[model samples]
Target: MKSAAKATPAEDSAETSTQLIRDSIRVAIVERRLSPGTKLSENDVGNLFNVSRTLARAALQALSYEGLVSVAKNRGAFVAYPSPDEARQIFAARRLVEPGILREAAARITPDDISQLKQLLLEEGRLMSERGQTARRAEIKASGDFHLRLAEISGNAIMQRFMEELVARSSLVIALYGQSTVSSCGHSEHGDIIAAIEGDDLDRACRLMLHHIAHIEADLDLRERKSLGLKEAFEL
Candidate 1:
């Protein structure tokens, strides 16, 4: 079967509509564009990206699979509002998954992977250095790209898919309960992880990955949700 994914053109060619939908929502969540409980209407998303509702459904379903959004029987879809316990579980899962990926990558990461990872870091650092913690396109792009790059090194498509999903959900959790919008995910830890991996210290690389995820969990305020309108903004 052909995958639900279909490639696009130039800038769009690199990402399919489903991936686009997944990423758009992910960005909105990470950058505080969509807060917890934000309603996502199908028609809205279809219009924003100029796609059919069919494609939008695919995107939303992909996110639901990742636990970033909830699609109710009759209520349509809304951003996930993870309970504190659920939040803890998410981080715990990340601690295991990410560290394993780091350790495996350290064992087999190629020079090209290192080069790409470094390039990605440069983009991430640039995003963080911007004047404001703006939800600029580049910032969102970098956030997702970081996970994609790591998954590339991990060399397992299924688990890598899980990481991508987890990363998206992590963004949702951050948007909802984040303590400060300044830095939802630490901007510098990737380099530390890379350095450890490059030095062939698998233990240290694993530790660094664990610590990085812990820092993200620490950023969550866990109090309650705020109102950001990805739904209303793009009508999606």
Candidate 2:
């Protein structure tokens, strides 16, 4: 196999900085530290990271494209607040995509992959059991990461990228419409899907995956939009 190409020092540094900024904001959003519709000023981000406005702008632009942030002409950026209709559409798209991914993963997954997934599930369970704002936030992020890991195991780079975007958008949807106490995707349900995959039961895995997605979508209280504010948004 051919070796992967290495980035030059300057390129690596730039990529690392961009990724750091992106991840910081993404994690904040996933943890609900940044609430939906909260304005994200470039200067605020730059100050938070001790980075340049240009880098902050690039990070915000990237997030906007991921559907986690919305940008308006001269209005600056804000965390995306998915409408009920948009929330429905996001879940509908996930239903279309995730089952097939699980099926493929079931067929192709190795023993090590299953082990890793079990470990993640364990960690998720641990986080869920802990009581605190930090534990709750970690659990939320872990729940979304589970689906992203499934996509990664499907061994499709394109699908992996698609799921990454979908999961991020789903975070926004959950922030806006999900009931406060309901787990985004229940840890038990995730375990069931993983069990099916481990057994190499493609049909069962796909079915469980669909059910899992539906269950999450069903938990949403989409009748009314959640109110937003910068104070709630910026708190970590």
Candidate 3:
């Protein structure tokens, strides 16, 4: 067989730069460092990442496709500011999709899967117990990751993709509408779901998953939007 073509240095550099910009923005948004409706200037992103405007633009375009960024004529790009109606729709979609995901995961999850999940929970508990901005950010990410991990265990590619999008949008919803008093996902509830899955109790797993999601949605202050600052909005 002929040798496979290799990426040139320029191509590799461009790809790396694009991914760096994309991932930085994505993590910033997901971690709530970048708030909704914050303007993303192409120049600023290029400067921040030390890449060309073209690469920064490409990164923002990718995020736009992921529904985490909005691009408008003359407005450049901004972190998405999802409305109350959109929030309801996102949760509604989750309600339909996640129960099925849990059902499959419960049936197929191996002992190793249970072990891995327990480890993740252990780490989550430690992070939640810690104090400071860094710990809180890690906790939030780990909280969402639990559901994403379940989606992976389900062995459904489409459901996995859907869960990825839903979880990302859920971060945006929490940023916009979530109340400070309510935690994202309770550690105890996660433990209960994991126990049910380990026992192959499909119905119980599904029920617990639905209840978990509903608890998160119920914590949102969806009646009004929170005001955000420009500097705090687009820190990256």
Model 3 compared with the native: what TM-score? 0.86
TM-score of each candidate structure, all chains considered together: 0.77, 0.87, 0.86
Question: lDDT at 59 for candidate 3?
Answer: 99
Write down the lDDT of every candidate, Cα atoms only.
Answer: 0.73, 0.84, 0.85
1 against 3, candidate with superior TM-score: 3
Model 2 misplaced stretches (Cα beyond 4 Å) = 1-14, 224-236
Ranking by lDDT: 3, 2, 1
For candidate 3, the per-residue lDDT at 92 reads 93
Please give, for residues 60-168, the per-residue lDDT of candidate 2 as tens digits: 9999988889999899999998889899999999999998888776767778778988999999999988998889888988999899887877788779889888888
Cα RMSDs, all models? 7.4, 5.7, 7.0
For model 1, what is the alpha-carbon lDDT of residue 84? 72
Candidate 1 per-residue C-alpha lDDT over 1-236 given as tens digits, one digit per residue, 9 for 90 to 100: 15522112125345776798778777677556788788888888888889998888788887787788889987788888777778777788888787777766666688877988898888888777776546454575576667667765767777777877777767666655677755436667778878888888888878887888788788887753334466755666
How are the candidates ranked when ordered by TM-score, highest leading?
A: 2, 3, 1
Name the best candidate (by TM-score).
2
Winner of 1 and 2 under lDDT: 2
